[model samples]
Target: MPAGEVRLVFCNAPDRDCAERIARALVEQGLAACANLLPDCLSIYAWQGQVEHAHETPMLIKTTAVRLPEVIGLIQALHPYEVPEIIALPVTEGLPAYLQWVRGQTLPLDKSA
Candidate 1:
């Protein structure tokens, strides 16, 4: 539960294709260890001046604190939405080996263990 041990970056896309693209890019760039896409998510919120409901594909991006800023920047640059929801929540508890793997995957090749 250290302040920034690991982060789960929550993001949503209008469709599966967009979600997949973002997930793949994050993983390929080492900004995220992996991304889990949850399909058929229903979101109700107010955009501009009216309440709206939409089906979205939510992505949970696994990464380390050291890689958070870069990950956010990448998502911002590639996301289709004018204002994508990129929320990072700290991982308070998880299997040690799994957390280690996430860190390893997100680190640069030359810096990985």
Candidate 2:
């Protein structure tokens, strides 16, 4: 796979359960190749002109640029937050085989398969 073909999406959920739910949906729907839920994280951000802090579960989603839009849409539809955090970063370099696997996994499922 070439550079920029794969994306690493960053998202934060209210808790482990929420993160798991989102991760499962993304991978099951083929919008993401994998979703890694990290340990509890402390997030301090500005919202509505106020600074807020929360313990959250950080998620790392692996997918392709082609599936990014659908991935974002699904997260929004399932996320509880009024405005969820979803960021996609281009994969500039990685093990060739791993990147290829990511691409293949995210491809739209073939109905005839």
* Model 2 RMSD, rounded to 1 decimal: 2.4
**Least well predicted 10-residue stretch by lDDT in candidate 1:** 104-113
Off by over 4 Å in 2: 1-4, 110-113
* lDDT (Cα atoms) of all candidates against the true structure: 0.88, 0.94
Q: Estimate each model's TM-score.
A: 0.90, 0.92
Q: Write one digit per residue (lDDT tens) for candidate 2, span 1-113.
A: 44339999999999999999999999999899999999998999999999999999999999999889899999999999999999999998999999999998998767898
Q: In candidate 1, which residue pairs get closer than 3 Å at backbone N, Cα or C atoms, i.e. clash?
A: none
Best candidate (score: lDDT): 2
